[model samples]
Target: MTAEQRPPVRGYAKPVVVPERLDSLTGPTTGIVVLPRHLKWSGNSRYDLDQPGRIADLYRTVLNEAATSDDLSRYLDRATLLDLWSSMWLPVALRGKWEDRFPELRHRRYDPAA
Candidate 1:
């Protein structure tokens, strides 16, 4: 095909879709969550929230693989997210995307005397 006739290549990266409000996060408070194949096709996908650090692990997984708004709304909660935000280990892309959408999520140190 000629250069002019060639179709432009589109990016495969999906854009992050954050809800309008943090309150929109209404996921389970406490329970065992089994991720679907789409979100977690490999490794163990069951997360027992009752266990130590399991909730954070679950949140990390969901935030990384969630393909739709419903995924986020169904697996993450505002209170839980906020509690783990500072300590949660997240990918740079996910962190940037989420922080960009919600500036309040960016953790900053409180300067006592600057």
Candidate 2:
């Protein structure tokens, strides 16, 4: 197949930032919360939320205040993150089998001591 005839590969684009939506001053002084844009996926393409780009975006938007591992754990559960990783990054054929083998991926019990 010619280069042009081959299917085009999808790539990650920078997340759309809404300055107005972001809190100008974030910290103890300001109690404002900044919510991230919802993760959107292109139909059935290799592109999905599990990519580093998307993960970075998620951290930027949802977990911006997660300074420490403990803080991060409180903000978002590890299982949720793993689920996204499995669902979005894993090949379709492997998802069910992989999830079955690794049931722990379904939900991670939070342990602050750890």
Candidate 3:
């Protein structure tokens, strides 16, 4: 799917508090739009949720980093990590037509055992 076609990332549950006096003219605004912590894209200056590829890339990074880190095991067990790896493509899969563009994403099949 094209980046434009992707949906905006969900916002944080708590709105960011903008300081009342950034400048004399600017007033305090509640919930100023900001990127969701979970959805932040690596190497992206701006937040664009429409790109499923970004999510895929982020998952790839997470998997790679987790594999090399000893601390990851303390937070997540093997089963949980495996499940996360298996389902990493869910976002791109749900969008449809992404396989042609991103071959890295494997097609998830229904496995009775799973």
Please tell me which predicted candidate would have the highest lDDT against the true structure: 1
Candidates sorted on lDDT, descending: 1, 2, 3
Tens-place lDDT digits, model 3, residues 47-97: 232454443344333333332233222222333323344456433423232
36-86 per-residue lDDT for model 2 (tens digits): 223223222122344455443443334322333343443343444453443
Indicate the residue-level lDDT of 80 in model 3: 30
Candidate 2 structure lDDT: 0.35
What tens-digit string does per-residue lDDT give for candidate 1 at 5-44?
A: 4354344265556777888899987889998987788999
Q: Choose the strongest candidate by TM-score.
A: 1
Candidate models: Cα lDDT each: 0.77, 0.35, 0.34
Residue 109 displacement in candidate 2 (angstroms): 22
RMSD of each: 8.6, 15.8, 18.4
Question: What range of 10 consecutive residues in model 2 has the weakest lDDT sum?
Answer: 16-25
Q: Which model is ahead, 1 or 3, in terms of lDDT?
A: 1
lDDT of 3 at 21: 23
> Which stretches of model 3 miss by more than 4 angstroms?
1-61, 90-114
For model 1, the stretches where C-alpha displacement exceeds 4 angstroms are 1-14, 108-114
